[model samples]
Target: MLKIDDLIIDKEFEELLPVLTPEEFVRLEQSILKDGMLDPIKVWEEPGTGRNIIIDGHNRYRILKKNNISLNYWENYKFMYADELPTRDDVKRWMLEQQLGRRNLSEAEKYEMVQKFKSVFEQKAKKNQSLGGKGSTNLPKVDTRKEMAKATGVSEGTYRKMDVVMKSDNEDLKQKLREKKVSVDAAYKEVKSTDQKPITVKQQIDRLDKRINDIDKTIESLQVEKEEIIQRRTSIFYALDIKCPVKYRWDKKGYSNTFPCFWKCQIYIENEEYENIFGEYSVYYNEFPSDCDMEKIPETYRNDFRMIWKKAHDEIKALQDEVDKKSMENAKKQDEILKNAMKLIPTDEDKVILKQFYRVLANTYHPDNKKTGNAEMMKHLNDLKAVWGI
Candidate 1:
C-alpha cells in the first residue's frame, strides 16, 4: 500500500471530470487533515500512456483537488502494467476475503471499500487508455449481439438479427417483438431487407424513413397493450380507505342508523396481548369501514386481498430490481454522455444547464434521502440528470 502523502498527481489527471459532490470533497479533505488517509491508493503504470492508473481512492482524489491540495502528499504503489489491475471477478473475490474477515469490519464498510476499490481500478484503466500508451490490450470485445448468442447458445447470425429487431427504433417492430406477437427473427429479417440500400444517401434516408414509420405504428399499438397491463396491475394492487357520511338522511332516525354502508378502511398494525396473561401479538383491522362482517367474509375475498398484497409486493420488488439494473445502465450511459458532451466543448449555456441538472439530481438522489424512499429508484434519478445534461 502506498502512503497518501507520497502520491503524485499526474498531469493526465486533469482529464478526469469532477463527479464527486463538493460536500464529499470537503469531508474527505477533513478526514485527510485529521485522522489522515488510512488506505493507500493503488495505481498501475501504463508504459504507452505515460501515466499511472488509479486503483483506489477516487473520492479522496477529487476532494484533494477541490481544496487545491496537491497530490504530492501521496505515493503511488505502481503495477508494471495496466493489465495487472484486478478484474470484476477479482474484486468479487477480494470482497469475499473481506467478508471472511467480517469479525473486524462491518459489512457495510467492507462493501463500501470494495466498491471504492473497483471504482478506482476502473477510473485508472480509463485514464491510462485515454492518456497515452497502450494499456490492457487484450480486453475482450463486447458486442452484445455476439455475447448474447454465445451465452444463450444461439447461432450468431440469428442473434445478430435479433439484436437489430430489439433495437429497431421502429415502434411497430418493437411492439410486435415485445408482445411476442410476431416472430423476432422474421421481423428482423424483414426490417433488414427493407433497409438494405443502394449505397446512396437518398436511398438510405428513404429506407430509414419507411422503417421508422412502420416502427411508429408498431409502437403505438404496443403502447395500448402496455397501458392495459398497467391498469390490470393497478386494479390488482388497489387498496381503498373510506370514512364518510351518507347523503340521504332521515329526520327521525340518527345519522349512523339512516344509511349503514361499509366504506373502505385504513389498515393499521398493532401489537397487543391476546389475553391478560398471554404475550403480545400483532393484528390487522379495517379502521375506517367500522362494520366489516369478519365472520361472513369469504376466503376468496380474503385471498383476493392477500393476492393483491402479494402482487403489489412482487411488482414493487420487480420494479425495484429493474431500478437497480437501470441505474448501472444509466451510470454507464451518463458516463458516455459526459464524454460526448465534453467533445462538444460545451459553451457557457450548456455548462449552466449541465450544472443545474447535476445539482438537482445530487440533492434528489443523495444517499441520505434514498434510505427513506426506494434506493434503487432514487439512484436512477441521478442517472437521469446525467443523461439530460450533467
Candidate 2:
C-alpha cells in the first residue's frame, strides 16, 4: 500500500482545490467508512520513480485510505489511460482539462480550476519554447498572464490583488485566501498595509542583526573555501614531493584585549617545514572573521572612524585573492596529472580484460536489478567510462 505522504501530486492540481480541514477530513472519512467510495480514483504510475501519481479523485482517495479501504481496480479505482498519452506531461494536461470541464463546480472552484489550467498551460508553453519548440496548446506568447486572467473571469485589477494574496509568504494569510475567509480586496489591503507600515525600532534592530549574521556567514563560507584551496594545493605538493611553509603576522596597532588584531597571511613555497597542513577548517586554531572582534565601537567616533571596516575588507579581499590564485595553480597541476594519466594507452590484451570487468560491473549496476543495483553507482561508472574514452 502506498503511504499517504508518498502520493505525488501536481502542484498545479493541489493549488486548484483547497485542502480539507481536519474536521472536514474526519467527516469524509466517516462517510466513506459507512457508504464506501462511489467514485473511481484516476491515477497513473510515475515514469522513472514507479510511484503512484493521482490525476483525479484525490479527496475520495484520501478518505478511503483514512478509513482503511483498499482500492482494487474495477472496484474502487481506475487507471486514466489513453493510447495517445505517451508522456506524463500529456496525462497531466488531460487531467487538468477534465477538471476544468466539470459542470458541478462552484463559482470559487471554477475560478480556481481555470487559474490552475492557465498556469499549467503557460508553464508547459515556456518549457516547450526553452526546448526549442512551440507549445501544442496554440496559445500566443504576448500578454499571457493578462489573457489567462481574462479567460478565467478575473478582471485585471482584481487579478493583481489576488495575485499578491496568492504569492504572499505568510501561511495564515494564504490559508485565509484558500478558505475564502477574506475577500481578495480585503487580503490585498491587509497585505499592502502591513507591507507599507514603517518598521518599528525592534524590527529595524532585528534587520540589522540579520544583516550582520548574513555577512558573518559569508565570511565563514570564504574562510572554508580558502581552507579547501589550501588543502588541495597541499595534496598536489605532497604528490610532487614539495612542501610549502605558511606564515602569519598580526598587526599590533589595532590590538585590544576586547577587540581583535588583524593579521596577514603568506605562503613560503621554497622553505622547509615539518608541520602545518591546514586542510578543513577547525574551530580550535582558526581565527575567522566570526572569531574576530564583536565589541561595538564607541558612539563617540562611530561615523567618522571607519578604518576598522576598511581594514577588515582589505584583509578579506587579499586573503581571498591568494586562495583563488593558489586554487588555479593547483587545478593546472591536477590537469597535467590527468593528461599524463590519459597518455597511458591500453594494449589489446588490457582492453580485453577491461571489457570483461566492465560487462560484469554494468550487469550488477543495471537499473533493472533493483535489489543489487544503485542508480548513482551506474551513473558514476558511465561518467568515468566517458572521461577515460572507454
- Number of the top-ranking candidate, with TM-score as the measure: 2
Q: Runs in model 1 with CA error above 4 Å?
A: 1-18, 53-55, 65-390
lDDT by residue (283-322, candidate 2, tens digit) is 1123332322323322332332233334444655565567
The lDDT per prediction is 0.46, 0.58
lDDT tens readout by residue for model 1, 225-300: 3654554433333322321111111121232321222111222122232111111111113211112433322333
Q: Give the Cα-based TM-score of candidate 1 against the true structure.
A: 0.21
TM-score of each: 0.21, 0.38
Alpha-carbon runs more than 4 Å astray in model 2: 1-17, 45-52, 62-68, 82-85, 94-119, 127-139, 142-144, 147-152, 168-194, 200-390
